[model samples]
Target: MSISSMFSNKTSRRGFIKFCSYIASALALPASLVPKIAAALERKPRLPVIWYSFQSCSGCTESLSRAHAPTLEDLIFNYLSLDFHDVLQAASGEAAEQACEQSMREHHGRYVLVVEGSIPLGAKGAYSVCNGLSSLEQLSKAAKGAAAIVAIGSCASFGGLARAAPDPTGARSVAELMQDGQIMKKPLVNLPGCPPLPVVISATLAHFIVFGKLPELDGENRPLAFYGNTIHARCSRLSFFLHGQFAESFDDEGARKGWCLFKLGCKGPSTHNACASCKWNGGVSFPIDSGHPCIGCSEPGFWDSKGFYQPIRGNVPLHS
Candidate 1:
């Protein structure tokens, strides 16, 4: 019941090559390497993934499972072979442990470890445990043999709400753990958000598949393509932001009229993510578009900030 057990389908070399070709086209890869990429895809084999949760809400999972283009079914069926996710897997108790062990042993040197939520190290990892094992122990064991590690959600990437002042749980990010202890030699990619936009997740995965490696990352290990620009750069209400026409309240005329949310503690300018462009619920609406301020959930330490309702910097004057 190793990590390989999570993979439900087998992709033949020929079929994988064909899929690679499609990815090449999708990412606009040059024609000369299309065949090469196709060949690599066919022979490289599907990466096995192990998703682990910790001391936090499963919003990241919920968001990812409900991704716009590739729903949970498509992700499970097509993208990666998710072997042992406690939340999604039906197996429990010793059965679940056996399944995870089986996949780990089978996949061995190659697998993607996706972690959500922060680990509590203060209480000797007692804050969160699964089947009598501490979250930190599980993460360390799994990360040791993974090909690449993805820290999903702000909780996992930057220790979200759990790391606030007077931190009783001792919540910490995967990066801190990795830096403190040598867990794996593989690369680590951080996708920070209260719950990253579904498209952002899909796009990151797609980039990995297309490029055969982690996407170009920022100083924070965030994908440059997705986190390169601030949300304010592409905000639909930029004009309003510039003019200081902000929504005073949730039901104010400004809000109803689609004005900016900057005055309402909008963190668009300070945060970076593809939310405005990638959107949510199949491009229907994002927080700002839906009349809420940008909470900067994608950035680290957003929850512990001074206030969620205070405008950033608190000095910009209102325009006419």
Candidate 2:
């Protein structure tokens, strides 16, 4: 069925246009492009997708699946033909592998590759294997035929906790693996977070479907529209930060008053992401709003950067 027909039966045309307008605004696209975005969704062929998981926890997948009621993420999933995702698909063993291989064959040079977790290169990649193949081996083969690749979450973007100190597994980010082995010669985008916001993922996919290109990226290959500003800039306690008022302890009076968390180990000053504006759990509240300090999970090397509870001012070593 045509994308428009699928939605038209469910809601008025005005309602669908309003939905598209919200998505366009969320993507930082100009207001004038709302109609274009709606048109693209109606006419564009459903893009094929292949998702691969590797050396870390499956928290990213969980995060993506947490999109709230009247789930827009579910709609996005329907918009694309997700051929292979081990966690979500029912097929297993040889059957699953065959489906992935078949999709790659059918959509060669056109399908989108979404990779979660990091790739382990240690012990000949014996640390993590899929269908008798190492994580890196699977990634290399899948990426060869992909038109675009999205590294979802910190694990896939920067090796995350899997590559933390002592690094036994030799876990590496998708970009690092691609660089080392000289593969995945396609547009690559990184969506980093402990587990990235579901809206960010949905909006990014929408941008790709509408524009037929990757959104603009920052130095770390993260989408600039979402990661352009530091959490501190849009933080609710920015006035406290500017006035030099801070909470010295998690439960102190200053903290109760919602003073800046910088002195209490909030990484908002250094972390760049949409958490401040987009919030989480359907725009309800994010970490800082819930009284916990920002952990800087979106940045590279956040795990080993030291002391999540240590004040960012004097104790933590700041990395760009």
C-alpha lDDT values of all predictions: 0.78, 0.85
Considering every candidate listed, which one attains the maximal TM-score?
2
How much does candidate 1 score in TM-score?
0.85
Model 1 C-alpha lDDT per residue in residues 66-85, reported as the tens digit of each score: 87554666556666678899
- Any runs in candidate 2 off by more than 4 Å, and if so which? 8-12, 68-73, 314-320
Model 1 whole-model lDDT (C-alpha atoms): 0.78
Clashes (N, CA, C under 3 Å) per candidate: 10, 0
Model 2 C-alpha lDDT per residue in residues 1-320, reported as the tens digit of each score: 37656665575577667768877777788999998988887788778889999976888888878865225444544467888999988899899889999999999998999999998889998999867889888998999999899999999999998988988899899899777764656799999998999878877877898898999999999998899888888999888877889998988999999998888789888899999998998899999998999999999999987789877765332222
Q: For candidate 2, give the lDDT.
A: 0.85
lDDT score, candidate 1, position 144? 82
